[model samples]
Target chain A: GIQVEQSPPDLILQEGANSTLRCNFSDSVNNLQWFHQNPWGQLINLFYIPSGTKQNGRLSATTVATERYSLLYISSSQTTDSGVYFCAAADTGANSKLTFGKGITLSVRP
Target chain B: SQTIHQWPATLVQPVGSPLSLECTVEGTSNPNLYWYRQAAGRGLQLLFYSVGIGQISSEVPQNLSASRPQDRQFILSSKKLLLSDSGFYLCAWTQYGRGRTNEKLFFGSGTQLSVL
Candidate 1:
């Protein structure tokens, strides 16, 4: 089993501020994904970056597979971004069962 | 397009009561289904996953159990519930892909369970 750890268990920022959330895995992974759980308990897929970089609107993510680390970047954060962000990964040897990290609670104040 | 459905949106039950949560996926065939629990302010924990009908694998040994009665249906059940069972339950599905690269998971709306 692989262990995933997220940094800054909790975070708060101004509406127009920028932030970076990091995730580190203990072992190599074949699948890596980022999800945002909103206040209403909706799990929204933010990114599925096993490697390289991907940008969606004001949110971007980069996964350095070789380094066993990934980063989620939020730019000009909006109040709507307030929620818990989770990082999940699955090892290549398994049947693709995801193991999740505790997550980073982000609050963007308006 | 594939969609997953879970109900009821919220439930409250006394300790020792029976529990059942249902999840169904549409627009896909032979997809991998999963049940996960998220405690307050915590990460999602994988409870059970099924690759096909009648095939289930439990990730964590608990009082909870899951079953796949149909290709697109998954059910989570508990004969007796405990206060510790209170949490948000989510259902998700994914199509298997070649090698290790695959598409992202599609999650259901989620169910909030509270055991008194």
Candidate 2:
């Protein structure tokens, strides 16, 4: 089983601010994803970057598989972005399955 | 477009009571289905996942169990609930045939269960 660690367990930002959330995995992964759990408890997929970088609107993510790390970047943050940001990864094993990090709680103040 | 439906939205059950939560996916066939639990202030934990009907993989040992009786339907059940069972339960699905490393996971609205 792979261990996923997220940094800065909590974060507070002002509207329009930018922030970077990092996720580090203990082993090589075959899949990596970032999700945003809204206030309504819906997990919204943000990025499915196993490697390289991807951008979706004001949110972007980069996964360095070799480095066993990934980052989620939020630019011009809005109040709607306030929620829990989670990063999950599946190791390159026969029984690989996604293991999630504890998650980063982000609060964007209006 | 694939969509997942999980219900009921919220529930409050007494300890030792029976529990059953249903999840169905539409617009897809042979899709991989999963059940995840998220405790308060914690990340999602994989409880069970199914690649096909009647096939399930349990991630963590607990009082809960899951079943995939249909191609797109998943059920989470518990014969006797415990106070520790209180949490937010989520059902998710992904593209079929990618069991080695599942594709982009899509989650349902989630169900909040409280065991008193």
Model 1 lDDT tens row, A15-56: 999999999998888889999988899999999999999999
**Over 4 Å off, model 2:** none
- The C-alpha lDDT values of all candidates are 0.90, 0.93
Whole-model lDDT for model 1 versus the true structure?
A: 0.90
Model 1, runs deviating above 4 Å: B97-101
Q: Give the candidate number with the greatest TM-score.
A: 2
For residues B1-116, write the lDDT of model 1, one tens digit per residue.
77889999999999999999999999878788889998987788989888888988899899899999988999999999999999999999887522222668879999999999
| Residue B10 local lDDT, model 1 | 99
In order, what DockQ does each candidate have? Answer: 0.62, 0.81
lDDT value, residue B99 of candidate 1: 23
Best by lDDT: 2
* Window of ten residues with lowest summed lDDT in model 2 chain B: B94-103
